[model samples]
Every structure is written in C-alpha cells, then in structure tokens.
Target: MASDIIIVGQGICGSLLSWSLLQKGISVKVYDIDADHSATAAASGIINPITGKRFVKSWMVDELFPAADKTYSEISQAIGVHFYEKLPIYKLLESVKEQNDLSARATETGYEQYFTNTDVQYLDKGKVKNEFGSFVINGGGKMDTQLFINSYRTFLKNKGILIEEPFTYEQALVSKSKVIFCNGYKAAQTGFFRDLTWQIVKGEYLLVRIKDFYADRIISGDTTISPTSEKDIYYAGATYQWHYETEAPTEQYKNEIIESLNKMLHVPFEVVYHGAGIRPSAKYRRPFIGFHPEYKHVGIFNGMGTKGISLSPYFAEHFAEHIVNGKELLPEVDVKNILIKS
Candidate 1:
C-alpha cells in the first residue's frame, strides 16, 4: 500500500509519531511485531516533574508536560479510550538531608508548582512506612501505556495502516515512502545510523498485588509504585542498569525490588509479573531526530530513555511539523548536530 511514511516499531515513539502525522493529514503504514520485550510495554509511564536523587525538576518539564497533556487528551478523545491521568506523586523522604534539600528547593522561585506541600504527609502506619516523612508533588501523573498503545494500534488497524511484522534495514532501504525507525534499543544493534552514539540501559520491573492496600497516587521512595487499572495491582521498581549481559529480567533485580517493597510497605504482597526492556539513550541525553546524513529517505525518532512518556508526544508533534511544513527541528535534538561530534 502506498503511504507518505513507513514507520518501524509500534512502541510509544512510533505510535505518537503516527498520531501526529495523521493529525496533519499524512498517511502512515506502521511495521512492528509488538515484541514482549518492548520498553513501552514494561514502562510504568510515570510522568514525574520532580525526579533524581537531588529532587530537582526534570529537564524541559514546563514545556513537555503541557504538550503531553494536550496530545494524550487529543488521542484519548479520538480513540474514545481513556489512558492518561493526572496523579500526584507522593515522594517519600529517605533521610534528613533529603528533607533539608526539599525544604530548600521549595523555597526556590520556580519550584512552587511542583513542591507545593512542604509539610510532611503521613499515610496509614500499617499500610506503608512514612517514618522519614513524605511530600506531595503536583504537575505529574501516569499514562496507561499498554492501553494507549493497544487502542491506537486498533485505530491504525481500522485504517489499514497497521502491519503486524518486523521491518528490517534491507526493506527500509528500498521502501517507496520515506521510512522512519521508531524501534527502541534495537536501532543501535542494526548499526544503520552508526554515526549516533548510544548509552543503552536495561530496566526491570515487577507487578505486585497488595490486598486492601490501595494507592490513589504514585508512591516514590527507593522505587516508584504506581497503581494500574486492575484493583490491588501496582507497578514497582524499574531499576536502571547501565551494564547488563542480556535484555531479559533477572532474579537479582526482582529480589532487589522485593526488598525495596518490603522496606516501603508494611503489608504482605504477591508478585504477579516480572518484565524488562532495554532503553536506547543518547550519550548527551536527548532524542535522536531527523533523517540520516547519507540516506536522506531514512529517519529516526528514538532514544527517549526514561522520559518517553513526557518527551514523545511533544517531540513527535515537532518532528511531524518538520516533515509536513518545513519547520526547523529543535537544535538540541536534531540528528545533524548530534552526528557532527561522532
């Protein structure tokens, strides 16, 4: 079938890019196998404005968060499926130093949006531990990644643009339409865009069910625990491993998550699922966007890393504008500038 663009991979990148393109009246044919190891499938889809050990604001949060909210709402309305939600984050302070740091950050001029509640928030003593105290962070939420992806895939299928198969470099080279690779870490493996530098990371997580322990908001401490649509089930512990022998889940990481859960929760829980995925990150920590230098017809929209939920929608719209209306790509994320160093 003829299309304006052919997209490889149906992860968050591919899905959002296609959505953006479709909004611009562009036709797209997507290629993907929906592999079990998809990073989007394993992601908890937490969009936390305040992150890191220092408890500072995430990069580009002000711009990215609004774009995410708009794009997700648009897609949800179009598909008639509700997957995006704005939930507060309950950041549990681990030490006195962390408490002091948060206190200082709350006094900062621009941090008031996220750090509104400086008072220590307490939870039920039997349900979860809050000895060191915790604070509520606004301007953050969770995306039901699986639901969004599934609903959008169905949307594409109805339009006859969804091709459930793997697309390789050989096919990409000869495709009539411009081909864009939205595949995750496997893009590094293919070596098609060899000029780009990558810092691939493997992340693992668990699905646990705690009886009668319901969390209305995301609980963050040693690990993040976010509620799912299913009652009593929550996502926990996405460990970031810079070095790993394989992309598969490990017992060590699973146990580590269990240990953290034990420390954070006073109630007993049952682990129902374990999963992992490799995240393709750029060395400088920005998405790799734009066509390849040599192969003008080939393009990429990957390397979103841990911030895919926050980054993908806004950047997908940006990338789509560049393709449709001759808009200049962002200087920081454009691939031309990124490859010059390599």
Candidate 2:
C-alpha cells in the first residue's frame, strides 16, 4: 500500500503523530504486532508538572502541558471518547528536608502559578499519611492512554490505515516515503539506530480498588495513585528496574507496590491488575527526534522515557510539522551529535 508516511508501533508516539498527520489531511499506514502489554498500555499516563526530591517543575511543562491538553481533548472529541483530565497532584511530603525545600519554592515568585499557599498544609491528614504534609500542584493531570490508544487504533482500522501485525525493516515494501519508528524499547534492537544512546528500563504498575479511600485528585508519594474513570479504582505504581530479567510482571515487585500502597493508605485495597512494560529512555534523557543521518527517509520518535504523556503530543506535532513542512526541530532534542559516534 502506498502512503505519505509509514509508522511502526501504535504506542503513544505513533498514535499521536498519525493523528496529527491525518488532521492535516495526510495519509498514513501504521504497522503493529498487537503487543498487548506494550508500555503505553501499562502506563498510568500521569502528567505531573512537579517532580524529583526538590519538587522542581518539569522541563518545558509550560509548553508541553498545554499542547498535551489541546491534543488529547481534540482527539478525544474526534474519537468520541474522553481521555484526559485536569486534576491536581497531591505530593505527600516524606521529610522535613523536603518540606523546607518545598516551602522555599512555594514562596518563590515564579512558583505560585503551579503551587499555592493552601497546598502546603497537612491536607490529607485523615486519609493518607500526611505527618509532614502534602503539597498540591494545580496544573497537572492524568490521561487514559490505553483507552485513547485503543480508540485511536480502532479509528485507524476503520480508516483502513492500520495493520495489526509485526513489521520487519527487511520486509518493508513501501520504503519510498518516510518510515518513522515509534516502537518503544524495541526500537533499540532494530540494529539500524543502535548508535543512539538507549537506556531502556522496565517499569511495573498495579491497578487496585481501595475501599472508601477516594481522593478525587492524584496522590504521589512512595508511589503514584492515579484515578481512573471508575469509582474508587486507582492505577497505582510504579517500580523502576534498571537491570531486570524479563518484561513480565513479578510477584516480588507486586509485593513491593503493595508495601508502598500500605505506607500511604490506612484502609485496605484489592489488587485488580498487575502489568509491566519497558520505557525507551535515552542516556542524555531527552527524546530522539529527526531522521537518521545515513537513511534520510527513516526517522525516529522514541525515547520519551517516563514522561511520554507530557512529551509525546507536543513533539508529535513538532516532528510532524518538521516532516510535512520542512521546519527545524528543537535543537536540544534533535539527534545530531559530532561529539560521539558509534
């Protein structure tokens, strides 16, 4: 089949980029192996603006958050499904050092937009362990990524642009147009882009039903408790394993998540689901964009890491424009390096 673009993998990146191109009236043929346990399927899709021990704002949160909201909302309307929400994240403080550090940032002039004074108190005292207190960031939320991706997949299938199967680089017949790899961790093993710094990691998460322990907003402490469309059901996770044996979920990590959940909650909960996937993290910790220097028609849109929710939508539009209009990419994210070659 002839197309303007050929996309591999229907993860978050491929879904968004293809949607962007379709919006511009461009043609796309997406190839996938129907990997039921892909990263995007297991992701909590939490778009947290505040992160780390210091609670610093994420890189390009101002830009990425808005773009994500706009893209997800618009596509949701098109797909007849609501996938994104604007809810605050209540970060449970662990120590006095963290409390002090947060206080400084909360008092700073530029921080008020995301953080507020009322967000600094012992907010969830009766609900969760808030001895040190919890701070809230207003401009953060979660996306039902699996639902969105699934819906988008159906949409593509309906349009006759989706191939629900594996695609090998050796067997690619339609190679005239650009072929962008959005294949997540598997992209590193493709043998073509092996020179790119791929620091993939395994992430495990659980979905549980906590009785009467409902907090409308997301809770981030020992782990993240993200609310779903259902009542009292939250997506809880995740454990980062740098060196791991298999991609499948383990009983040991499931126990670890339960332990962390116990640390945050006083009530009982039942584990409904346990799943694991790999993140395509880069050594430089930025997304990999632009075409391959050797194979100019072959490009990549991977390395979204743990921030795929916040990163993919914006970069999808950016990279889509770069292809459709010959525009330049964000210099820091563009993968052209003379310093190191492999």
Which has the greatest lDDT?
Answer: 1
Task: After the best TM-score superposition of candidate 1, give how far the Cα of residue 224 lies from its true spot, in angstroms.
Answer: 1.0
Name every residue pair that clashes in candidate 2: 32-165
lDDT of 1 by residue, 4-104 (tens): 79999999999999999999999889998974458887899999998888888888898999999999999999999999899989888888887788888
Candidate 2 regions exceeding 4 Å error are 1-3, 172-174, 338-342
The sequence of per-residue lDDT tens digits that candidate 2 reaches over residues 229-342 is 878789999889999998899999999999998898877889998989999988878999888777677888889999998999999999989988989998777765511354
On TM-score, the candidate that comes out on top is 1
Model 1 misplaced stretches (Cα beyond 4 Å): 1-3
Residue 144 displacement in candidate 2 (angstroms)? 1.1
RMSD of 2: 1.9
With a 3 Å backbone cut-off (N, CA, C), the pairs that clash in candidate 1 are none
lDDT of 2: 0.84
